[model samples]
Target chain A: MELLVASAIGVIMAAGVYLLLRARTLPVVLGLTLVTYAVNLFLFVTGRLTVDQAPVLNQGHESFADPLPQALVLTAIVISFGMTAVIVVMALKSYVESDSDHVDLDPQDDGEADS
Target chain B: MNHWIILPLLLPALVAPLIALAVRHDIVLQRIFSVSSTVILLVLGAILMGSTASDPVQSYHLGNWIAPFGIVLVLDRLSAMLLVLTAGLGLAVLLYAINGWDAEGRHFHPLFQFQLMGINGAFLTGDLFNLFVFFEVLLIASYGLMVHAGGAARMKAGVQYVTINLVGSGLFLIGVGLIYSVTGTLNMAHLATEVGRVDAADRALLEIGGLLLLLVFAVKAALVPVQFWLPGTYANAPPPVAALFAIMTKVGAYAIIRVYTLIFGDDAGASANLAGPWLLPAALVTMVIGMAGVLAARRLGEAVAFAVIGSMGTLLAAVSVFTQEAMAAALYYLLHSTIAGGALFLIVDLVNQRRTGYTDWLRAAPPFVHTGFIAALFLLGAMAMTGMPPLSGFIGKLLVLDGVRESSYAVWIWGLILGTSLLAIVGFARAGTTVFWKSAAVGGYLEPARPLAPALPFVAVGILLGASIVLTAFAGPVTVYLDTVAEQIYNPSGYIETVLPTSGHPEGVRP
Candidate 1:
């Protein structure tokens, strides 16, 4: 189970990095989303992998899983969702207005850069 | 148990939702509520500053939970000082925004309040995970504020800013995850104790985690090699928003100070000074790069943006020394640079508003209306920004130089700081003369540019510039206060004891 989770995170991060380096805005947004998924997994695993252990204490139980990382991951997921939404709208606006999804401003035209 | 420490966070957190829900469309009502909350925050911040000055360290655990278990908000001298600074900048920028700039966008008031909540929470958080959460809160609000008055340039910049910071946030999570995995705790005081007692076999992992955390802060601080996103984002942001962003970089510096001093200081077994060797060189290079950007910039706003980057470089270079005196000097510079940078941005906006064709471009265009008044303000702002004598910038540079006199790299620090100050002066002088003086020589008359930028905006800029003067005039008392703040940070035992009282042993003791 540990190996599976680690490999999944690695692969997701690899793909995210590849997409993030692209010159276009849409791919970059997608790349960021993918990377965030990997981050969430990493955060979740910080509490260690426990299949049957309860996150809450039972009077008779000797041990329970760490619950803090779970809470942290849930909060992270919600925040990332909001951030992705904002980025998507921003990318769409830029695409529609500039008619080019290229991320960098046009270097040849300084006046148009301001506009 | 002190409730005032939490007010800075709670006031903004409550008021932001209220504005969005009830006064979302009423600009007047939104202004009233936002301004009132910010004023209250300023008073609370001042009160906390005074109280913390005497006691030096206070912690408030949520819901009566014990330390190292529940969330905690720590208020020390450093956090209190930063709270006051954030409130001051927030109120000033909001006042400037109220002068018709708020009408350009929807939900401006709510977004502003949310941004404040994020900044204050970042300062007060005693847990690493909580810090990451506040960072997101601030970044999200910043995204909304960045593109507030939507234009193609703003949208493009906003896309880049959001993407870069999202990537940074991912890195932040990885960093926090690594630390939590190694230390088994996220409360900063507990982590400090754990780090000092980690097993020898785990030292390598702990070092990696520490470096990763430093990487996260470097991105936020706009340290070189990861600082490419700041210039465009700051330049394209609405002027008032850009002014408020002057405090954002300081958040990165603050994190570096808090985490490094508390968790990775001299006593952290293998992680001691993990970032120390690289910090100084990176800061120096960042300073050089930022100044070069300032020289190359074509627009006034871009120049100011680069100057901000330069100021961060200078501030961080002093802080990277990690001595109490150096930290004190860095804090003084931090306060000065925040106000000076914000003042410059506001002046640029005022100039941009009045100039018809040239806008804020640094070219000899037809003479702008109210050139004389704007020129004087611009000159004062430029002097403050470039470390000219008789302003806070000069005093800040002098203090940093004096503080770093004993370092091994004192020669390099001195040479780089002086060289960069020279470069900054030349850049500002050329830009100022071109915009204000050369234009007059070529056009010889004030063309009725746009009626004049309204008086209220000038008043806003004056208030900020006035604060810079106060910072200069009161440098002695401010330095004395920051000296105490730095002393408290360097000696983290008091902070650890306050936050984790249940751990009977002092901070460095292993359980």
Candidate 2:
């Protein structure tokens, strides 16, 4: 179970990082979303993997999962969800405004870079 | 629980939603509420700073829960000082904005208020997770503000800015998780106690987490390697918003100081002094890179933005030394740079607004309207930024130099700091000559020969520059106060005991 969760996080994070380095906005947005997922999962497992254990109090349960990480994960998910939405909207705006999805300004348009 | 401690956060939190929902259509009402709230915040911040000055550390437990299990807001001298600075800077920028910049976008007032709330909350919160949440609050609000008066260039830069921060936030969560998994508490005060108890085997994990968190803060502080996003974001952001953002990097610097001093300070056993080795070198490089960018910058705004990065470099280098005197010096530099950088940004915008076609592009255009006044403001700003005599910048640099004089890296610190100041002067001088002096030889005034901009913008810029002068004039008393603040920071036993009373310690983690 640990290996499964750990590998999943590693693979997703690796892919997210690769996509993040791309030159366009859409992939970067997708990359950010992917990284958020990996982070949420990583945060979730910080409590140590406890299967069949509840996060809440219940009768006769001998042990329980640490609920704090779950709470932390929920917050992370919401923030990342909202942020992804924001970046998507922003990416769409950039696409419409610049007529291109490239992440940087056109070489000549940025005066500081050229000079 | 003195409720006044929480008012700085609550004032902005309440007013932002009110402005957003009720006064959405009424820009006049929105400005009135926003400015009044900010003024109230400044007053509240002053009161809080005064209250904390001679007193012991204070903590506010949300929902009346005790420390380890519940979220907390801790108030010491450092947070109080930052709260005041944020409010003052926010008010100045808002004043400049209402002079015409706010009307260019929707919800500018509410977003500005939210930004303030986030900044204040970040300063005050004592929990690691809460800090992350407040960071998201500020970054999200900043995203909206970054593209507020949206242009293609602005939106593009906004995209890059949002993406980078999103990744930084991810790293922050990972760091927090790693730390929490090892220590089983997110309360910074509690973490300080728990970090000392970690086993040798788990020490590696804790260190990784610490360094990861440093990377995140370094990103915010715009330390080298992660410093790339700042120039684009600041140069493209609306000038007033950029000015307000002068406090934003300090948030990162503040976090670094807080976490390093409180959690990972001299008492953290194996994790002690974790940041110093890494932070010092990165900061030196950040200074060099920033000043070089200043020299290379073709636009006035970009040059100022690079100067901000350089200032952060200096501020964080002082912080990295981790002595009471150096920390105090860093705090002084922090105040000076925030005001000076902010004043410079406002002046850049004034130049941008008045010029006809040249729009802050550091070219020899005809003399723009009010060239003399803006030129004079730029001269003072340049003098302040380049560490010349009498202004707070020179005093700040000198204090930092003196503060770090005993360190083994003193030679490198002095060489880099002095070298970069020279670079900054040349950069600012060139831009100043081209934009202000060279315009004299161009024969004619800018076309259409516009009259002066509104007095409010000058007033806003004047207030900031005046603050710098005050900082310079009162350097003695201010440093005296900050020295105590620094003393409190390095010796954080007061902070921990206040946040976690003896009974407040929860059970240790099962791991």
Candidate 3:
């Protein structure tokens, strides 16, 4: 179970990072989404993997899955959702306004390598 | 009483969208809303500061939910101090902005109101999720305001600024997720406790989390490597917009102090905030870079922006040293930089207007604007920025260096003391020589009739400058309060008790 979840997170992270590194803005946004998924799962795993325990308290369950990480992950999901909306708007704005999603041909940043 | 914390948060969220009604009107309604909301915020912050100043902890459960279940707003000396800064600066800027930046009343009011809301939100939020929300509000409002006049220059800079901050926002989300996974509670005080139970091997994840948080703060604070985006963005922003922006960098400084002292202060053996190695070196570099940029910048606004970055670097460097006095020094310096820097920008805009929009420092400024009195204030303001005495900036620098001296890190202390003072002198001289030393040779910029000249902008400028001088007189008492604030931050046991009374041991997962 741990192996399966860990591998899943790794794959998700790999995919997101690849997209983030893309030249255009849309792919970078997508990359961020995938990264969010991995990060969420990775955070969930830190509470240590629990097979059957829901964070909710029931009559006879011996140990509860840690409620703290559960609560935090839920909050993370909400904030991430807001973040995704922001990035989408940012990309769309960049696309409409500049007609390109590439990072500004920054005068200061890329000069050393290009020269 | 905990609900009073909500006032700062609630006022902007409620008032922000409604600001559009002032669009067609003159600056009157805009002034009322911006000034009133910010002044109320300042008063509320003062009360919160007083309430928490001597106490160890105070908590307000949102909607009456207990900690570990519902979201909470925690107040300690550190949070209270930051709240005062965020609110006080918000009011001052709003005040200056009313007449100074309100030349075109159309869109400035709404955007200014929204940005203040965002800043206040960042200061007040105890939950990590809300921090991101406030950042979005601030950044989005900034984007609109940056290009409010819709010029190509402003728009171009806005694109880069928005894009980079989005990247920063993304990193922040990932960080929160990682931290939540490890600690379980979103309440900062609770997370501090939960974070300690994890074994040393798992600490790297926390370090990454710490780094990401630091990354966001560093980007905003405009520290060394991530700092390049700040100058272009700030320089092109409209005048009043630039004055408001003067306080924005300090928000990042505030967060760095809060997070370091609260979240990562203790996690000693293995699981530190990853702040140690990078911060000191980076801070030194940031200051040096600031000095270098100031020297190199041809445009007046750009020089001011670069100088602002260097002052922030000095503050951050003090923070990285992580001693009580060092923190106080950083705190004092943060306030000094915000006031002096903000005043300088307002003056820049004023002088630029007089020059009829030539912001190049080396270009001859309009002669009608620089009477001996005005020139004298400009020189004195420059001196204050450089830490010369009988002025506010000097005293603040003394406290910080004194803190450094006590730490006994002789070389770095000497480096910060001598290096910062020397670079400050160089940067100020470079910009001032171009700006004030020579009288304007113009048939170029027209002379205005003596009595018919602009009165209001200079009045606003005088108020801002006078406020800074007053701070110098009260410096002794203020430094003591700041020292106490520093102690609360470094040892946040008092902080923990205020938030979660049952949680005995102090744990530092985050601030």
Candidate 4:
């Protein structure tokens, strides 16, 4: 179980890094989403592997899954989605305003350079 | 009355859609929503503070499920104070928003009101997961607010800000997942107690998870290397919007304080596998660099951005030390800095209100009437930032430095307190001279350099200052309350029990 989760996380992170280097704003947002998936899973894995163990149940079994990480991840997923939406919208607005879809290195300084 | 606790969360959420849909057309309706919501928040904040001040461990278990299962809202004096500040600032910003709002029924007020829901919720939430929800709510509103005027510069900056923060959110999720995988609990109080039960050998996993969480906060807080997006985005944002964000940074600082104290709890030895020692030095360094950013910046708005960063540095530095005095000082100073810094930023926004001839510092210089008073206020706030005395700033500095001084690491305390203070003064005092005093060749006067007879906010600040001054005299008692806060946070069995069923108290405060 650990092997599967770890390998899956590695693959997700790799994909995230690849997309992250892309020049376009949309891809960067995509990259961020993918990376978050990897991260959420990775955090989950920290509690170690627990199969056939429900986090919600009776005692003396000496092994319930770590429920804390699961709870935290649920919140993370929802919040991350909200952030992704906000960024995507902002990027779209940027594209519309500046007529550019690619991320620019040097941000315009309110055009204060000339003044 | 018990259910009244959720009003802070509910009123904002309920009113937001109403404001967005029904009140979009009439400015009058917008004012009513904005004003009413702000007032409601203020009253709610005061009630929460008073109720929780002595008890200091108040919890509203949403659905009453108790810890290890249910979601909860916790209110304590520390969080109570911050809630008021957020509401107070929200009120002031909403008023400012009314005149500056571009069009009718644009849903701006609704978004602002919704944003408040997130902030106050974040402060009050007892569950770790809920913090993320609040953050997203606030972040979404901020994105709209950032690009409200639809300017190319802000839009560009907003895109970067969004990207950077999204990455941060991703990291945060990963951290949360890891912590759950290890701990099996999400309620902060429950986690605090259960966390201490883990084996020492397995501590590395928790440390890594803690670092990931810290990384997320570091980005949100805009600490050192992660702070590149702040100056660019903030500099371009409408002054009012940027001013609103002045308090936003404190959210990050507040999180660091909340999570750190809850999970790690005051230097628990090296074997405890805590996230403190590293954070302490790093926080100090963040401050030094933030001050440097202000010193290097050319423009006034950019300078303020770095100074904002500097304030974050101080707040986090106080948190990293994990001392009662330090924590209280961090809390007090953070509120003071946010309100004062936010007001100053608003004043700058007013400075750019586009009179026919007048402009920003770069475009032209304006006349000075009450400019001296404004300059003095900035100086006072800045002086407090430096830990200079008599004012609340001095009091805060004394508290923080005293905390570190009491600890064994004397050199670390001195280096951080003295060095950071010196750099902060350099950053603020220089900006004070240039922005307010050096009235240069420009077109004409813009908005109030200082209001003719002191506007509502100015008077409001005078009251805030007076309260803070009173705080200095009451520092000893407040310190005792803060000590209780630190104690309650560091050891949360009581909190966990309150959230849990009465049977849960059978273990009887085990940590």
TM-score of chain B of 1: 0.97
lDDT string, candidate 4, B325-388, tens digits: 6666677667667765666566555444432233344332554545666666666655555567
- Can you rank all candidates by TM-score, best first? 2, 1, 4, 3
3 or 4, greater by DockQ: 4
Each prediction's whole-model lDDT (CA): 0.88, 0.91, 0.71, 0.69
Model 2's interface RMSD: 4.3
**lDDT (10s digit) by residue, model 1, range B1-511:** 8988888999999999999999887889999999999999999999999998678899999997888888999999999999999999888888899987888889999999999999999999999999999999999999999999898888899999999899889888888888787777889988888898788887787788788888889888989878899989999999889999999999999999999888999878777877878788889999999888888888899899999989999999999899999999999999999999999998888877766666788877767677888899989998998899999999999999999998899999999999999899988988898789887677755454445445778778888999999999999998998999999999999998999875483432112
For candidate 2, write residues B457-510 as lDDT tens digits: 998999999999999999999999998899999888889889987675676545
Across all models, the iRMS values in order are 3.3, 4.3, 8.3, 3.9
lDDT of 1 at B127: 93
* Global lDDT of model 4: 0.69
lDDT of 3 at B509: 30
Candidate number with greatest lDDT? 2
Question: What DockQ values do the models have?
Answer: 0.57, 0.57, 0.17, 0.49
What are the per-candidate TM-scores when only chain A is compared?
A: 0.89, 0.86, 0.82, 0.84
What TM-score results for chain B in every one of the models?
Answer: 0.97, 0.98, 0.91, 0.88
Output the worst ten-in-a-row residue range by lDDT, candidate 3 chain B.
B444-453
> Against the correct fold, how does model 3 do in TM-score?
0.86
lDDT of 2 by residue, A6-114 (tens): 9999999999999999999888888898899999999999999988787675668767888889999999999999999999999999899999999987664433312
Candidate 4 deviant stretches above 4 angstroms: A40-82, A105-115, B102-105, B266-273, B354-390, B440-484, B490-493, B505-511
Name model 3 segments beyond 4 Å from true.
Answer: A1-57, A62-102, A105-115, B21-27, B53-56, B100-107, B267-274, B365-374, B441-444, B447-454, B503-511
